[model samples]
Target chain A: MRLCKKTLIWDTSIKWLLVKKMFFILLFTCFIFDAPVAGKDIHVGKDHTIQTIRQGLMKAADYDRLIIHHGVYHEDSLIIDKPIEIIGKQGAIIDAQNHEVDIITIVADSVTVKGLQFRNVGTTFLSEPAAIKISKCKYVTIQNNYIQDCFFGIYVGNSRHCRVINNHAEAAFKEQVSAGNAIHAWKNKHIQIHGNRVHGYRDGIYLEFVNHSSITNNNSYDNLRYGLHFMFSNHDIYQNNTFRNNGAGVAVMFSKKIKMINNHFVHNWGGSSYGLLLKEIVGGEISQNHFEQNTIGIVAEGATRIIISDNRFTSNGTALDMKGNSIDNQVVRNNFLVNTFEVVTNTRYNQNQYMNNYWSGYSGYDLNHDGFGDVPYRPVGLFAKITNSIPAAMIMLHSPLVNLMEMGEKVFPGLTPEGLTDEAPKMKPYAYD
Target chain B: MLKISAVILQNLLRNKAIFGYLVLLCFTGWGMFLYESQPEKAVLSILQIVLLVLPLITLIFTTTYYYHSQEFLFLLLAQPIKRSDIFAGLYIGLAIAFLAVFFIGIGLPVLLFASGMQSLFLLLSGLLLNLVFIAIALLVGVGVHDKSRGIGVTLITWAFFAFIYNGLVIFMMYQLSDYPIENLILVLSFLNPVDIARIMVIMKSEASALLGLSGAVFQDFFGTAKGGVVSILALILWSIIPFWITHKMFRKRDL
Candidate 1:
């Protein structure tokens, strides 16, 4: 009986030894072989082992990086199907040489393209041929790229969680009718586009069907259409972007829950131009914006629940021109300085409320020392009304008789709508950042 | 002609009203700059003052000065000077005094505080307006010998340029609201000196945007070099034609 029990214990010990040996062997194999699986680098240059970028890319496995050297490569559209990093070493140049499609197309997720230059992209009226295009990808980052003479600089389609940073693009096209946007996105979600400078495109940054995006610290100027345009895009925030010398300025249409903060719209002077055009917007906040020397500032049409506060408008055509459905929009705490017309409305009475605004044209003083004007300021002047009715009448604005007529109208309060007045007009301008 | 102009200018400079006008203008310029605290804001206010008050002051002052200088002109007319030289001397003296006022009052402040294309254009516009209105005063002064009638016509002209003309243009726009009368309005704007000055200055300023769509039309009319030349030609015509007509009337006058 004792002998049989000892044999059973020995068998248990041997089973334990076998399990420990297998674990050590597995650990050794992983430590030796798994190092190359997660990390690998292939060089693309004349003297390198990989002669071409395509060869380097083919040799690289998933999660491997392909380093491109400093040389101008005459390549067409190259597709990346693996999760890898394409880092251009020492600012490598990729000339498309009039390619058929995009210069660089990335199809895989978790891919990053950085420190590269793309030039001479193909122009097509049908498909969007961009310098760099990402489609149906996730967790992608495109940064530090310089693109010139391209139809579209950086384009993303059906992508999510993408970051576009520090890219400069200029189209230099005279015919802007056929030019695409500099940074065009469609069907993208959770994208962050920041620190970009774009010029001479149809639109600077255009988004359609994009949501949950943030655009910040970008300078978009001299575009054919809007500096920043959105259609059916929702829950987006754009801040600290300068839109200057654009054709139509920044326009947001059919969007909701948008926050536009601390932007500068400067010198977009055209007959049909506006500093910021809001149409069909719902639940948006436009605050701390600076509109300087623009044709018109804050033209709202068919918008609802928009809060326009703490904005500085200097030398605009009209500070705020509204028509169509006013729908509970609020204009408060803005400085309207040296504008030709303060407020022009399509209708005599609007649903909007104007409160605590400072007008350079205001004649009434703060008599009671309450920091508010003693008399309510009527922003809609006779000239504004006449101009609204007949924009052609603006050419007659220089006649001294118009001043007398305006003065008479102001005293008697007949022609200009009386209800379009700021009740609590501020005596001082708000210090907007 | 030069000696006569110098004498006329010196006599005009001794006049207290011109001194007071200069003081008021300089004070206003300095006060606007002080209150506004920025050159751009100061420039805008100066623009309004130059547009409205400067032309009116120039009109009334020129007409009155011409009437007041009637005896001096008769004395000069008795001398060996040509009729054209006398007329030219009187106009040039008065214009120089007004130009001095403009330079000290508006022009100096603008050059000191706001040095830009816009401010320079506004100053130029103000000076142009001074010349144009003086020419108009000269025409009315020469054509109508009766002091009351001449002053009346001058007042009427000022009223028309300052206020009534714009009113009539607005009425036309209202009547033709259905049509695209922007071009017609542009043509009519060039007819008035004030309108021309306003358009020229406003279009040159970055606030050219303040004209809005009308600005675009104005730009097409006055933005290009060719457009600029056309408007300049028109302005020259406005300035010279009135003076030419007055010169002819002065040369053939019974005075």
Candidate 2:
């Protein structure tokens, strides 16, 4: 009886082990076949089985490529929720039909929308719509897209590691209140905006609360408002961009640790326009920029610890309108050529330092032949002071009395900002690369 | 009147002082363009010459010429010519000679080197200034009998316009700084032809600076087409009114 009972226990144990082995095989097969191992291309066009982008997206799985063929698609409010690539074939267009909605809304990680034309996302006062809107996404790229007449182009919000590259956006709004910005970014981190051309919008590039971003090689012109506007952004670098013919060229306000280099600000002329308006900015480096024919080249208000060097200011209304609130800023190695006023300020005392600048209006001779002027160059003329106090006195610009008063102020060193002299004014302009 | 004016123009052109003045202006205009790389800046330097040296020379030369040509004027007066015709002939002759010299000296360089609306405005203002100063010189010549005293008055007039008048305007502006004195400033600017000419050129060249801060009144007055027309008319009136007054003096004088 004992032998029979032991054999029964061994049989049950062997059956249990076989059952576990079958379960493992079933799970392995499910892992291998249930989920796609590689991304597959899903075609959408007139001849393809998939008739529309929305249907293709519905049929697609994760890690799939939606290939839009060469045709115009009247689609709006298309939401992209999967980590897939949407690539357009040659001449592929997406027309929103002047709809008051975004053309494409991206909410997934590792998504890319490339080489598409988006048009006619109409203006809306209640909502800020865009041609391509990316929110709450990571590793998204919106590249080589042509957007026209959109409220906003390539708007990115609450995003990380996103890139908007090689996109062109244009609008025809005549008023600033009716226009939106191109390449608008808000609360984004690690954003890269590069090689974009934007015009006729309120602002070419607008940033708010964006950090660790870089904007490079953009041509922004003819905007109704600022070409580039930065507010409350930190640690951003913008370089090699051309901003021209905007209401005001570029305004960087309430920002810190900004590096602006090799940018060109041209032909920004208006009653209150400026090539670069820096307000409440701290700890920035502005170098190697060209400011030509601007109303005011650089206006610094409440800015601190900024190093402005190696810039060229040519034919501006006022080269540097540094207010008294801006302190601890260093202006060095700049060439100010033919500006009406080299430096105009509201206060009589200067807290900022001006050194090694070559002013075209400087008449001081260099007898020592050391390439530095013997006399310290006073940039603030007496007329600048008069205009600062009584703005109507600007009619006296280039008057004989104004010229004589400026000369007298130079000899006497009175009325015009006392400590605002360039100690070592360069006799020759520094050659820039 | 035309024949008399032609003879006087010929005589004035032959004078060495006028020829030397023309040469000096040529040197200054051409040398400025050659010295500065930018045509705008060269125009600015030439503007200085127009403002300061042109007025001084025009004042001194016109006064001296009027004094030295007294015998010729008396001879013309003794003829059957109308007194208005004689006065008109003298004024026209002086205007034509100076205008010719200025055109050849400065206007040619401006056309060749820096040809723009601003430069053309400078040339226009310079010509107007020449006419205005010549009219004032005639007024001095007719009003003051003594030659040395007339020359002194011309010098004082140039100083007052070029220096003291602006000084006084500046003082007035500062004193009335609390008020919105833009229109008042405009009125004062029109009171002096030199200031008017200066403002016109500056409005064109340094427009970006001038329009930004001078408030809306100045912007409307100076930054518009109407401003150009109005300023030119004011300058014309400046030239004409002074000559008319001098003409009245000459008509009523006991020669």
Candidate 3:
């Protein structure tokens, strides 16, 4: 009887082991062939409505992809409150049709929106027009979309580490009833704004209360007020952007550690125009940029520790307008060619360095041919020095008598500020592309 | 004729719509003042907006008012007055009434808000620009027989004044870029009323740094006492040339 019971137990155990092996094989095949339900796509537009898509999205689990298809979807505000990827196909246009405050507000993490056109953004007298509003979302990628006639295009407020790349934003101006900015990034950190073209707006890229942002390779032109206007934003880097014929080129006010490189500012001419207006800017490296035919090349008011080197200031009204409080700034190794004035300043007690810049009007000889002037080139004009203390002295700019007076001041060197000299000014113009 | 002039002036002064237009101007002035942190900057911005908007209001108001008072103009024409005298009287009456509204709405505030002699200069410049626009509008209204088409022409002229005229000048400069034509550029600037207004207002600011190239050229030619005289003469020329052309056109037209 014991031998029979043991045999039955052994048989049952063998059967159980075989059943477990079959279950393992089935699980492996399922893992190989089938993805999670979250990976399924929900179509939008045509026969499928956005509301149905949203319902599908709500039912979807994590890592789900919602594919919004082509055609203009006249939907109200779409609130995506889940962690899902809302991908749009080509020719997918989301027209809020001026019904909602925000066209699409994303509250989920890692949302990717591409190949969509947003238009007719609603604007209040106070609130900004936003086509796509993203807040508190992480790792969002917005790329390759055309946004037109919107107040604020793809506004990201209080978001971090988001990539806003390859978008176009056009906006309206001076319409008392409407309010919108093309691309507004407020209080965002570690954001990348790259390769965008923005025009006909109040401001092209407006940064307020932002830090550690990177704006690179954008073309902003014909903006009503400013091309790239920022206030109180710090530690930002902008490189390889072209701001042409804007109201004012770019206004960097009350910001610090902003590194601007390889930018071009050209033909920003008006009564209130400037190529680059730096008011209270601090601790930046403005290098390798080309400023051509602007009213002013660089308008500095109370700026400090700015390293301006390897830049070209050609055919500008004035190359640099240095103010009284602009201290500890280094204007080094720059090319100032055919500007009306190289440097204009008042009350030059600031510890600024006007060294090693090539002045087209430099007359000093370099016998050694080391590309450095044998005698230090003093770019501070006699008229400018005199006008610092006497505001009315500017009237003598083109007078023949004033030329004689300037020659006299040059000989005496009493009216000019002491130690304000370009000690290593280049003998010829610096070669730049 | 005196009664007609008095009626036009009263209608302009007492109208709520005209007062409402003043409110828009006031808001623009206030908005300019609010955005600019410095008082001087604020004054400059307000002056620019005023220069830009005042002309539009003047042109539109004159064109619309002239159309509305077409019966009155016809009745006066049918009476025992010469056509030229009737036209001159109407023009003088419209100019006077518009100037009164302009002085109250734009001129007084510019004077009150701006500092020193700049205020007075801006006030005069604004008035002159306003007159140029009104004269241009009157010329258009008199020339075109169709009222809607006339209004369209006035609006188009305003748009040209506000936006496209500058574009044309810039395009011309671009075309003439390779030439050493600074003197000719100065001549070209005088052709546009907006450019005149811009130069006059900007020459007042501490932006010689920004205006360096243009200012140097302007100062060389127009910056001296001689330059100042030339600028004044240019302003007077801008005011007169448009009126002269308009008057010539008005005289030749049958209406």
Off by over 4 Å in 2: A1-38
Tens-digit per-residue lDDT, A1-433, candidate 1: 9999999999999999999999999999998998766678778986687767778878989989888998888886789998899898875888888775898899999999988889998788888899989999999999988888888989999999999999999887777777888999999999999999999999999999999999999999999999999999999999999999999779999999999999999988777789999999899899999998787888898989999989999888787888858679899999988787788887867688889999877778887899999888888888887777676666655345667677788788887766778887988776654
Q: Write the per-residue lDDT of candidate 3 for residues A175-226, one digit (tens) a residue.
A: 4235466788888888999999998777888898789999999999888778
lDDT of each: 0.85, 0.91, 0.74
iRMS (Å) per candidate: 2.8, 1.8, 14.2
Question: For each candidate, what's the DockQ?
Answer: 0.36, 0.35, 0.04
Better of 1 and 2 by lDDT: 2
Better of 1 and 3 by DockQ: 1
Give the candidates in order of lDDT, highest first. Answer: 2, 1, 3
Best by DockQ: 1
Chain A vs. true chain A, TM-score per model, equals: 0.90, 0.91, 0.85
- TM-score leaderboard ranking: 2, 1, 3
Best model per TM-score: 2
Error of 1 at A127 (Å): 2.3
